[model samples]
Target chain A: MQNKLHYEFEHQAMATQFSIQIVGEEYEDAETASMLCFQRLDALELVLSRFVPDSDISRINRMKSGDELLLDFETWDVLKKAIAIHQKTDGAFDIGVAEYVDVFRATKQGILSDFEMVNALQSVFKKAQNASIYVDPETPKIYCVQEGMTFDLGAIGKGFALDQLSELLEELSIKNYVINAGNSSVLAKGVSKNASCWSFPISSAREEFAVQLNNSAVSATGTFFQGDHIFDPRIGQNICNSMYERVWVSSQSAALSDAYSTACFLLEKEQFNELLQNNSEIAWIAISENGKIQFFTQKNIPLAQYLIS
Target chain B: MLAGTGLVLANPFTASASVLSANDKVNVAIVGCGGRGSGMIFNNIPKIPSANLVAVCDIVESRREKARDRFYTLFDKKIKAYENFYEMLEKENLDAVVLATPDFWHMQHSVDAMEAGLHVYCEKAMSNKLEDAKKMAQVMKKTGKLLQIGRQRRSNDRYRFTHQILLEREKMFGRLTHAMGQWNRSKIWTMKPNKQDKIDISKLKQYGFDTVDQVYNWRNYTKLGGGVVSDLGSHQIDIFNWFLGSYPHTIYATGNNSYFNFEQADTMATILEYDTPNGPAIGIYENISNSRAIGVYERFIGDNGAFIISEGKDNKIYRESRVKSDVWQKYIDAGYISNMADMKKYKAKQSGDSGIMETAPQISYNINEMRDMDKVYNLPAHTAHLYNFIESVRGEETLNYDAETSYKSEVCIYKIHEAINAGGAKVTIDPLEYIV
Candidate 1:
């Protein structure tokens, strides 16, 4: 019953709560754009959901043999972006560990022999070596020759979804909006009611905060708070247990931030700094298991921007 | 004549394929079974429409098996996998291929894919070698294929929006003159060869590396990956080109591997000169590895203000303007002002020209501050690159930031590297050389 043309909306999707602030002349348009974002996200979930056994991705997994496989454009887009990050990170940040991840689950559940599970995990990693796949830009075809090669987009799916939602909002001519998925990944389109850039604390408990956005993108990464379920396929261990418990990254895109934060957590301080040096828009706040928070900022942001006062 | 083998457009002047009225489903392929390839397959999962996962290729059987199993367990999507990129490219009737292989493999894979009648979205730096960069451009022209370098920033709305503001907006910076960009980093993990390994280490010997760790961490070394300069500098330096409105005329550079002790320069500083249509310009780009001192950032200094951009962080503006003082008055009287009346004739000039002494308002803004103006000015025309790519496939608007625009950014990056190598020697760039 709000009479204002602009409105704020939030929902839970992709295992994270996402919210959008839409401002436009027509209230319905803002709401419609916000509504479309959720609908699109739901549609994306239908294809990418790991839990959906009959999803498009699941169908590809069930295929026995095919030289050329067709997918919904959404699925193809996610796969292409994931492939790009996988190559850039050099396998440090991989989504192909679904098998090992599943095996890791099976071993924990006592459903498989520990030795057999180890062998299976090793096999998965072994076959992962020669998986050369490409997405053709002309016909928009996805091609793969190696048998047993599957693509997963977990790490970057939410970012892509956010990007889609942002596009929908823009098409509706909605500006002055902020898209936040959980507390980790966010995209801000315009300034808030206040003249200041959209600002948020790295943590609610601490007064120290970072500028969440400036008509750019921001993404946060950490293992699920409740458990150590997120596993690194690289060494077959829980990433949360091995490295910083929580890492938050602010960038120009939620996808890059999401990727960098996850990748940075796996890297030592030095590698993270090197990454920061390369991408100037990335500002970071990392909290290790010991409850130590390290703050990093690039040249573009001044110390004052993050200050609430 | 045909460019090569990819596109068979009835008209090449427009470059854009004829629009399809209804949403069109594009079939896509994934090349390389490694992390990047698989990652790309998954990330774009929800955006485009009517895409086929069709194929996956990798050299190793084990890696392919893992991919297949994961696809089944996660999405149950069945895909054909192959060992060789060529076999897959030849066999798969793909419209596009996302080349997510290692940097060294980009040029060959892209050329082959184009010749095989597929468009390409190859990963960054355009090529691992300088020769490959030129060859990639040539192959694209010959094949008439759509080639998008993996410099995703070109597709980013924020960058597009900002670049537009810097280039088209008047009174934005009021004649930008100087700028600086830095990619400072800390130490990176140097992988050591494991004594006992599961994978073959023999291939490592061919590359002069002892083990898989060295191969995996090739970015830290020089042989396979483009050290920090190419790996990181290419991105930020590309930003310099985007903001400066033109490529530099001269460049100079100095670098050291003091921290990483790697073969190539890990830390480097470069200077570039650009002559804007309006005025002369200069920029400094620094890539540091020892410490994340300034992190990564770019600063655009103009006569009236400065713009700051950083990845993952906020884009900000710090304001500064010319201040009038007694020294300024004397300088203005002496000869600084080209069209000035005699200083000896006017005592008011000795004190201060009240008009010249006025302080201009601060000229700076963050993305948030521009909404009111954005709506009024209708700025940021290129903010819809992604949607455009999607719609173009769906027969909506034509694709913006095509191969030519992307190549423009790469040309600037390559010139920076060349300049750095020549001790920051100034190099003139002919824009036509990069345009197909």
Candidate 2:
């Protein structure tokens, strides 16, 4: 058996940091693969980043009702995935929450008074909920049937990009790799030389355990970074409850892992079980305020037991 | 000041003051009204209250006309527009002229403007051809006119703070040993000539352009521009030289147009050797046309720390773990640096929960706070560069990057260009060659 070396590269994108680690016989090939992966990530960011004035998402946000615009294939595919997830999550995961984000940001910055912030947030929520955003996946054309609809892909853009990175790496014939978007989301492929399966830790106050992941992605979501900034579209307000401290989801698809992790943070236990019943590929672990853990998948029962122990 | 060997110091502002009065508004004219030129017209000139834009000149008629109308509409002042630069130089009583023309025309326009008794602010990669670039410097020396090269990073507040305070004063990153910079961008620089913006072929040929696209997107061709190396690499490489305080001794480069299929090489990487005062160091730079992945930034690594600095918000400083934490704590206390994972700013209630264990302490400077401070204290990069020129013309400040200093970096850039064109050849630059 040949011992493989690992190479890693770190870069900043989507207003956060991302890293790629690959195990290969040669470092140069791994470096090249990493560069190519970052290129795909950059292209995705140019289309998806709301900060870019001319990005497709930004252009869509600025469009009036009845305006039809052409979107890139990548943008169209991501939106299709987003719409499907929105349906699966029963509208718990909405991309049209950018308006609420803007209002919250304004209020935090003291740009809007409390009365104005409430009125503005309520107005934007109503518009966004009622706004008809039409997407033709075949033609990749988007029509804004109603105005005041804005999209913020912050929750899922990184995972979507990581999936693209995986595709690029696979195209290059590089098999063993682990790509991480910040510490919140990760995609792992193949096992390391020393281990039979790639292992990641699931930690809580009372205990910590290692879950072996192979050809899979894991995404964790919490109020750890910005504190209750994740707005629940159903409530038309941010999630301030401390009951759900953190939620982690593992799936073969990074996009699904990211979306479900976010949805699980707000979903009831029975609701999450229902979601898992329909989508058996996903495995989830959620931690509550009292350091209690709950597991919702039997994909790898031994690994789950190893983790819980 | 002259040396014993009769070498003039190449200081263009030492002779005499041309625009002396504090109250006098410096009359300025733009020599090129294309992308960068028009940027200066709309963005830079409007920000400088002491400078008045008096005329606009370009070979393209529509560009000059639009520039004229833009200035008129924005400032409510009538400015003259001309196709011939000499005609504009002859008519306008300009104290300074901003040369945003193509690399091939930089020498002719800057030399002419200086000989016409006006100060000059010429854009970077001073010229495509080395001889023309040298002559621009020589003319500045002979004519005794202030010539400021548009290496706008010299005027950037963050860069200045990094060089002056962090590196020089505080010795933040000790014994700088290596520097690397990259400018990766997608293939979108090519310009398609709009029907309304098209120029007659005869007029284009008169300006030495064979096609309208060539006239608009000059940087893509070798005859009119210096390709990606000179167009993009020059900016970052200049920073390497500036911060290192030394010229590169040797250069080896490799580039190809395999991806973009453009006339010039679309991707290039160069390794530069330098002997700084501390010791010998290496500089590596690459510009890729197919990937805007890492975006653009320059990193300086040392024994104790490293910093990633750019005009963009992707600026950061990191301290090596071997160094004592207390050494950097003073900088953090003094607000020179900040923790990369800033937990204090997060409003989340801290649980004793250990969610994930980090492998290492990711320490990074608080660039956002620094940038916000920059907004209150400093002008934007482009406006600051132009304002520096205007101030130097008015005898308020000396030129930041005089022609001679800029020519030295251009010499190294042209060598890298030569090596890349020769297919990964290594070029040795003599110390004497840098003395323009």
Candidate 3:
């Protein structure tokens, strides 16, 4: 049996903490590889971050209606993924929530007064349904068909960064790695030493539970940190008082898992079950406001039995 | 002026009092009114209380005029514009002059200004030629005038604190082993001149510029600039030499103009070998003009800890995991280092460990604001460098990078350029060559 050593590196990116852990024998190579991975994340942030005044996404948001802007391949790919997930989640995942996000951030910074907040929120909600963003399927160009349309990639950027990190690590030929971004999004490959699967702890207000994951991505979304920061694009309002305090989704793709976890947080039980039935690759665990935990999975092995044995 | 503010010795070395008060203002002029020269006029000089913009000088008439117009628009001071630097020096009673000319012209302009009994703050890559750089330092020695090089990182508060307080006093990042730095950017650095701001062709030809584009993008030429190695790598490599307290003994470098078909190399990498007091160390630096992937920063790694410091907001200090956490805890408690993750802002409901899990322990330091009595200011690094020069001229502060010290790093840079131009050859340096 080969003895494996665990090495981790931490960096701040995309306004959140990112960590990469690799179980390997070559520690120095792993350290160098981790830095290179973070460099890739830095490049992605420069393209996807809306806070950067000159980022491609920020430039797109600033474009006038009927103006077409060419994008970098990475930016175009992420936006296409976002559009696909938006349709799959039945309008649950939307990137055109920058208007409400701006107001919320301004209010949090104490820059907006109560009356101004009310007016901004009403205006954002009014324009929420008419998000006329168009993307050319053949070319890497996006045209904003309606004025006042903007994008905030906050919900999916972390996952996209993780995907990029995974590609970088794979390119370096370093396997058996786990990447986590701010404890909200996670992706794992191979397995930890002496274990068939990588184990992570999921906790609610009442109790804590451990889940085993292998070659899969998991993301947990909740209102526990920033109150009501998550917005529902369908109604253009924050889902502040949802029944579930937290929702965790595990799937084959981090972007899909992240988008679904966010979408499932505001969904009713029946709606979530129906969505899960259609997407067999996704499994979810939700913790309610009353501290009740519910588990739903499509795998042949029962999750409760797997947890016990 | 003497009635309101008490008169003091205008020149400490001279016997004449001149009835000059400390607040009487130091008359200043600029020798090259290009982008960098005009930037100092617009961005830095206004922030300095003791500086007075007296004259602008450039071979190109439009550049000097534009600089004159900018200073007048910003400060409402109608400064005189001159076509020749020596003529400006002969006419204006300037206490100091900023040399922002091309790398090839820095030696002559700075030497003339200092010989004329005026202090000089010359922009870096001190000169495109090493012999000229050496002569400039010799003139500063013979003239007994202050010559400040524009290595702005030396004046930055964070870098100062890192060098003077953290490394020198506290022995932080003990026994630095290796240093790495990079500056990457996309696109060619070309400027489009306004139609109204165009200079005549004969004027540009007389100024030794073949075209207007050469005047704007002089950095892309070998005669006017130092290519990527000296233009970008010198600034970061100077930090390695300063922090390591040693000049490189051997250098191996390779560069090419593959990305941009300009006269200068667009991409370059150099390996610098240093023998510090603690042990032998090395420095690696690279500059790529085709991709701004990692941006720009310098990283110094030691046995105990490491730090990534830049003029940008990406500055951070990290403690090695092998070091005792309690040793770093003191810094965190003293506010020298703060957790990179702002755990205070968010409350985790079910906490075993709420944040991302890490196998290695890392602690990061955030840049703290500079606090005066009631006013707190976080001046940019370039402004601080200019402020330092202005204060040094008043005999209030010593220069952070004197010509003699800066010449040592320039020697190393020129060696790398030699190796790169020789098609990736290794060059050795005599220890005596490091001294001016």
lDDT ranking, best first: 2, 3, 1
Candidate 2 Cα deviation (angstroms), residue B387: 0.8
Clash counts per candidate, in order, are: 138, 0, 0
True contacts kept of each: 0.00, 0.00, 0.00
Estimate the Cα RMSD of every predicted model relative to the unseen true structure: 25.1, 18.0, 19.8
Cα lDDT of model 1 by residue, B1-436, tens digit: 2112111112222233211212445666766665456555544532234455667765546566556666555455677777667777678777777776667778878888788887777767676576677788778778877676665555554455555543465445567798788876545535332222235556446434565655556676555667776778777777777777777766676676677677777778878788877699988888877675456677888876677766434356554546333423332343322111111221222223323433323323344312212321111111133334434444544544455555666666667666656764666777576664
User: Just chain B of model 3: what TM-score?
Assistant: 0.88
- Kindly list the per-residue Cα lDDT of model 2 for residues A40-116, writing each as its tens digit: 67657867887653367866776776676655556777888888888888877777787778777645554454555
Q: What are the per-model DockQ values? A: 0.02, 0.02, 0.01
Please, what is the TM-score per model?
A: 0.48, 0.58, 0.57
Q: B11-92, model 2: which lDDT tens digit per residue?
A: 2222322121225789999888876787688657765767888898988777788789967765567889999888877788
The clash number for model 3 is: 0
Candidate 1, residues A234-266: lDDT per residue as tens digits? 565554455665777666767777776666666
lDDT of 2 at B224: 92
Candidate 3, residue B216: CA error in Å? Answer: 1.9
**Tens digits of per-residue lDDT for model 3, B210-276:** 8877776789888888878887888999999988988999999999888888988898899999999
- Score candidate 3 by DockQ: 0.01
